[model samples]
Target: MIDFYKYQGTGNDFILIDNSKDDFKANKVDYAIKWCDRKFGIGADGLIFIEPSTKGDFLMDFYNPDGSQSFCGNGSRCSVAFAKFLGIIKDQTNFEAIDGMHQAVISDKHVKIEMQQYGAIESIGNDHFIDTGSPHYVAYRNGVNENIVEYGKSIRYSDRFKTKGTNVNLIAEKGDRNIEIWTYERGVEAETLACGTGATACGISFAQKHNIDKGIIEVKAQGGHLRIHLEASKNDKVYQNIWLEGPAEFVFKGVIEDEN
Candidate 1:
C-alpha cells in the first residue's frame, strides 16, 4: 500500500505522494493515467510526486490525468502546503518544478508563489496568448450563454495549437482590478473549476490591455478567488515579479494499494 494525500487549490485537486525516500516503484505516467480516472480510481485533476531536490527544498513532479507533464501552478501551491504538512519546510520554501525553481510562502491555508517572468504576450485577434509556466489563450467575453467546453475546444484544438495544445481561458472584466475567469485545460481536456497559470495569464493580459503596469488583479473563478500581482517593465512588454496567491486546502489522506 502507498500512502497519499489529497489537496486542492481552488477546485483543481491532486493526489500527492511523498517519494523523497524513493519508494514509489510504479511507472509514473501509467500510474497517473490509471489513478486519475474519475470513475475507476482516486479521481483528481492531476498527480504529484514530492521528491528530494538537489536545487531546492523539494522537487514537484506533476502529471495530468492524461499523463501529460507540465509545470502546474495550483499543483505547486498544494505541494507547498503538503510539504508543510510533512514538516519538510516551515512557512516558506524554494521548490523546483518542470518550469524551474520557485519561491513560496504559506500563511495558514493561503499560499503565495512567485511565478516566472514572461517576456511577451502574443496577440490573437482580440484575444491574447501567454505562457505562465503553461501556455494559455485568453479570450474576453461579456456575459453570454455559450458552451464553454465546445468553444474552448475550438481554440485548444485549432490548427495553431492542435499539435501540443494550449489551455483556454474565458474571461470577463469586472473592473479595473477584478475579473472573472473560466479555464479549459488542455491536458485534462475539460473545464476545470480553476487554473492558476491560466489565471496568471489572464491577469497579465488584462493589465496589458488596460494599460496597468503594476497592480493586483482579483480573479474570481468557479472554484474560488485568487489574487495575481504583476509588475511590468520596458513599457509593459516584459512582466516580472508575478505572484499568485490563493487558498490551498488539505482534503484527506489515505492509503492506496499499488496495483502496478
Candidate 2:
C-alpha cells in the first residue's frame, strides 16, 4: 500500500506523496494516470511527489493527470502546505520546481508563492498569450460563459499551440483591479474550477492593458477567489515581483493498494 494525502487550492486538487525517503519507485506517468482517474482511483487534477532537494527545502515533482509535466502554481502552493504539515518548514520556504527555484510563505491555510519575472505579453490576433510558469492563452470577453470548453479546445488545438498545447483562459473585467476567469487546462482537456497560472496570466493581461504600475488584482474563479500582486515596469510591459496567493487546504488522506 502507498500512503498519500489529498490537497486542494481553490478546487484545483492534487494527490501528494511524500517521497523524500525515495522509496516509491513506480513509473510516475503510469501512476499519475491511474491514480488521477475519478472513477478508478483518488481523483485529482495532478500528482506531486515531495522529494528531497539539495538546493532548497524540497523538490516539487509534479505531473498532470495525463502524465505531462509542467510548473504548476496551485500545485506548488499545496506542496508548500504539505511541506509544513510534514514539519519541513515554518512560515517561509524556498523550493525547486520544474521551472526552477521559487519562494513561498504559509499563513494558516493561505499560501502565497512568488512567480518568476515575465516579459511583455504577446498579442495573438485579438487574444493575449503569456507564460506564467505555464503557458496560457487569455481571451478578454464581456462575460465568461459556458462555451469555455468548446472555445478553449479550438484555441488549444490550433496550429500554433497544438504541438505542445496551451492552457486557455476566458476572462472578463469585473471592475477596478478585479476580473472573472474560467480556465480550460490542456492536460485535463476540460474546464477546471480554477487554475493558478491562468489566473495570474489574466491578472497580468488586465494590468498591462490598463497600465497599472503596481497593485493587487483580484481574480474570481469558479471555485474561489485569488489575489495576484504585481509590479509592472515603466513601459507597462515587463512584470516582476509577481505573487499568487490563495487558500491551500487539506482535503483528506488515505492509503491505496499499489497497483504496480
Candidate 3:
C-alpha cells in the first residue's frame, strides 16, 4: 500500500508521494501509469515524488500519465504545497527538479514558482517553439474551438517533433497583456484543463512576436487563470525571471489499497 496526497493547480492534478525516507520502493513508471488512470487508479495528470535533496529543500520527481519523465509547472507548484503539508518548509522553499533548481513562495491561496531561463526560440513557419522548462509549440489562432485537440495532435506528432513529441498550446490574444490558451500536453496526449509550462511558453512566444519582453501577462486556461511574469533576457529572443503564479488546492489523501 502507498500513501498518497492528491492536489491540483489550475485543474492540473497530481498524485504526490513522500518518498523522502526511501522506503517506498515501487516501479515508478508502472505505478504512474496505473495510478494516473482515472478509472483504474488515483486519477491524476501526473505523479510527483518528494525525495531527499542535496542541492535544495527537496527533490521533485515528476512523471506523466504515460510514465514519461517531464518537468511540470503546475506539478512543481503542487509539490511546494505538499512540502508545506509535510512541514518541510515554511512560507518559501527551493527545490530541485528535472529542469534544475526552482524557488516558490506560498501565499494565502496561491503558489508562485520561478521557472528556468530559456534562451532558445525558433520560429517554424507561423508557429513558435520554446522550451519553458518543457518543450512547447505555441500557435496563434482567433478562437479556440473543439478541434484544437486534433490540430494540436497533428503538430505534436508531426515529423518535426514526432520522435520526442512536444506540448501544443493554442493561443488567442484577448487584449493587451491578456491571452487565452488551450494546451494539448505531450504525455497526457490530450487537452488538459491547464498547463503551467504551456502558459509560460505562450507568454514568452507572444512577447517575442510583439516585442514586449518584460511584464506580467494574464493567461486564461480552460481550468482557471494564471499570471506569468517575464523579464527581458540579455539576448533579444531569450526570456528570464519567468514566474508562474496560480492557485494549488488540496483535493484529498488516501492510501492505495491494491497495488497489483
* TM-scores for all predictions: 0.98, 0.97, 0.97
**Per-model lDDT:** 0.92, 0.92, 0.91
- Residue-level lDDT of model 1, residues 1-260, one tens digit each, is 89999999999999999998877889999989988999999999999999999999999999999999998989999999999988889999999999999999999899999997455898889999999999999999978355779988999889999999999999988977899998999989999999999999989998889888888999998999999998887856568889999999999999888763
- Put down candidate 2 lDDT per residue, 20-120, tens digits, no spaces: 98888899999999999899979999999999999999999999999999999999999999999999889999999998999999988999999864567
| TM-score ranking from best candidate downward | 1, 2, 3
Candidate 3 global CA lDDT score: 0.91
Regions more than 4 Å wrong, model 3: none
Cα RMSD for candidates in order: 1.0, 1.1, 1.2
**Model 2, residue 57: displacement in angstroms?**
0.2
Ten residues in sequence with the least summed lDDT for candidate 2: 116-125
Whole-model lDDT, model 1: 0.92
- Checking candidate 1 for backbone clashes, the offending pairs are none
